[model samples]
Structure formats: structure tokens, C-alpha cells
Target: MHPVLFKIGSFELASYGLMTALGYAMAAFYLLPRLKKINLDRDTFWNLIFIAFMGALIGAKLLFIIVSWPQLGATTAEKIANIFRDFRYGFVFFGGMIVSVFSLIFYMKKKGLAVFKTSDFLITALPLGHALGRIGCFLAGCCYGRPTDMPWGVTFTDPHALVAPELLGVPLHPTQLYEAGGNLVLFFILHKLYNKPHKNGMILLAYISCYAFMRFIIEFFRGDYRGAFIFGLSPSQTISLLTALAAGALWIYLQKKETKNG
Candidate 1:
């Protein structure tokens, strides 16, 4: 896979960065017209997205650094240096999602916005954006998968790719594309669910539950170093389990509340 989309002299455009930007843009486009239906203004929505974006970047980076500290370098100084040098890559999606969701909740409360209602709209667009971002990960050779003899396994030959040297040219299970495809399917499911009458936070709950399940399964295929394991499960899988349980509890509570109100 090509990490550098294009390079001219000293200018290099990374496929990961480019796809990430496109993901944000795509999410924005999907959310814009629907904001009015939720009674949210463009300026305020933009500000909220900015806040979430900053929070996501910080949270994702911090989690990545913490989890990958041992693998960063041999010495403390090398680790610190590598952290800054490779800051552009190594992001944990769950970390970003946790921070960004909290950031949005805080902003919505301060702005007196209907948190659940607005989140329903935003959550529906998440998978759409995330799908594209995974494509970027595939191209950049980050978030790679374990060795596989499957016919569809991908081999990364590009030196610029972020795949480990030992994995280079080896057939790997293309986990990035697997997640991307799953996200695309989830996006459609969520979008369809969003259009139907439901509870305030049902869409959000559905996203959390479905994505956690998907991520939990996908973790098995992932070959990259995923933080420390808890109960023989990777960090993402642990979070996925916790998140899925939380979403299930919330769904049950919401359903009971709806039934009682009715």
C-alpha cells in the first residue's frame, strides 16, 4: 500500500492524512442539512465539532503513546523523541470516541442543546466518516492484520507504509478494509434506524453496541501491538466489551422509561 499519496521534492501528502480530512469533510456534509431538523445552528455545530476534534486528537494520541510506550524505542529519550516524531500516526479509535463524546456532551450541556437528540444525528454520521478513515489506514499500512493464507490477504511492499518490517510483503488479513466494510454496512443500518421513530438516544446506543461488537471481533485479526491485555483480550476488545455492556444497559433503561411513560 502507498503511504504517501503523492510527493514532489520536499512536499509529501500522506494518504492517511488526506483520507482523514476527507472523512471529516464527508461527515460535515452529511450532518449539515440535518442540523436544522435538530434545531442546531451551523456556527454552534461547527464549534462543537472543533471541540470534539481537538479532544479526539488529544485522547487518541495520549492513549496510543501510553499503550505503545514499550514499543516506541529502547531508551527513555528515544521513546520521547519517537513520540513526537511519529505523532501524526498511531491513533486509537475508541480513545477518540470516548473523549469526543464526552466533549460533545459537555458542549451540548453548556449550550443548552438537546444532547441525546443532537447525538442521534451525529452518531449516524460517525460510521460513514469512520469507513473512509479505515480506508486511509489500509493505505497507510497502519492497523494491520495478522498473517493469513487466505486468497484475499494483502501484502504491503511499500517501504513508506507503516507496517512492521517483518510483516512487509507478507500476506495479512486486511483488517482495515474489513472494518471499513463493516462500518459502511453499519452506516446504512444506523441511517435507516435514525429515520424511524425511536427514543432520544436509541441511535447512539445502537451505534455503540454495534461498533463495539464489530471492534471486538476485529481485534482478533489485528496484528498490531494493542496495549496491554486484560483477561486475554486486547485493550480495544476490553473497551468494546465494556462499551457494549454500557450501551445495552442504557438501551434497557431507555426502553423501560419509554414503556412506563406510554
Candidate 2:
């Protein structure tokens, strides 16, 4: 896994950035077809996606920087400079997901589009595209797991894995692959659920619940000292807990409504 996909005489295209762009393109393309099923306007859908894309990037970076503030042995100015110097590093997926969803909802509302159903449309793409992006994470070695002695453990031998071999070469849990597989399964579940009659946004709720559960579990396997994990609960895990609870409550409410109406 090469972090820098390639270089052109001082300009390097990072695999992380490349994967992010590819993931968004895939997600947007997938949503285009599903948006029709949800009866959302094509133009509105595109606009909303654009807004969500920017929101996700900014939110993810902001949250990552905030959470990593303790580890920054650098000043605020240096950290700011680093972001400009290397845009490929540091992004928090859950932060981006939450921000993107809310921002897109706001955008769609301003456009007079159906926010709930469009949110559901995004669910179908979220896991699939997230899985693709994790493949990038595996290549880029940003969200790595803890050291391990498992036979199937992986070594960050690839330069794209970012961190040095001294810090990363030990046999480690392939958390990225684990997550990519988890997301793939979630994608299929959402895809099938979409075919059934459930309230709009229920699929998205389901995604949040499922993904949060997995992320919470996976945090235990990560060796790096994310503040969330440092205190025995990673920020992602705490957020996951909240997201799961909210999604569960919403799902139950929707189910009761359908039952009463039926």
C-alpha cells in the first residue's frame, strides 16, 4: 500500500486522497439511482451531495485535529501548517458521517427536497463506499490497529501505511480489512432492507446502529492512543454509543408507528 499513489516531480497524489475522491464519486453515483426510488429531484440530490462532501471533509478533519490535539507535540501554528502541508492524513469517519448527514439534510430542506427518503438513499451507498474507503485506509495506514501475534496478522511493510516500520511493522490486527468486510455486510443488509416497506430513514438508522456497534467493538483492537481509547473508550466509541442509542430509539418509534397504522 503506497500512501503516495504516484508523483510528478514534487507533486504527489496520495492514495488516501485518491480513495476519498473515488469513494465520494461512487457514493454519489450510487445515490443517483436510489434517489429516484426515493422520489428526490436529481438536481437537488446533486446539490445536497456536494454540500455533504464538503461538510464531511471539514468535519472529519476538524474532529481528528481536535482529538489528536494532545498528541501534537506541535504548536497550533505548526498543526495548521501541517494540515496544509499534508492534506491526506487524519480524518475521523464517524464525525464526517454525522456532519455530512445533518448538513445534507439542511441543504435538502433549503432545496425543498424530501430529506428523510434521501437520507435513506444515502444509507445504501454509505457502507459500500465506506468499505471502499477503508481499502484506502489499509493502504494509507492511518487508522491502524494494535500490535498482534496472530498468524494472519499484517505488517505495515507498505510505505503507504504511513507510519514507520519500527512503530507499525509488528504483526497487527488488520482492522481496516475487518471494518471493510463489516461495511460490506452492512451494505448488503441495507440494500435488501431498502426493498422492503419501512419508514424513510429507517435504513439509515439501521446503518448507524450496526456501524456504531462494530466500531465500538473494533476500538478495543486498536493499539494507538486515541484519547477516546486512552480513557478506556475512544471518541469514536462514545459517539458510536450515542448514535446507536438514537438510531435504536428512532427505529423503535418508526416500527410502532407502522404497526399502529397497519
Which candidate achieves the best TM-score against the true structure? Answer: 1
TM-score of candidate 1 versus the correct structure, residues matched by position: 0.97
Writing each residue's lDDT as its tens digit, candidate 2 over 122-219 gives: 77888888888988888888788888888878887774476555765688888888998999999999989998997777878888889999999998
Provide the global lDDT of candidate 1 against the true structure: 0.90
lDDT of 2: 0.80
Q: Estimate each model's TM-score.
A: 0.97, 0.91
lDDT of each: 0.90, 0.80
Candidate 1 has its poorest 10 consecutive residues by lDDT at 226-235
Worst 10 residues of 2 by lDDT: 159-168
Q: What is the lDDT of residue 74 in candidate 1?
A: 98
19-91: candidate 1 lDDT, tens digit per residue: 8888888988998988877888889989987887788788888888878889999999999999888567989
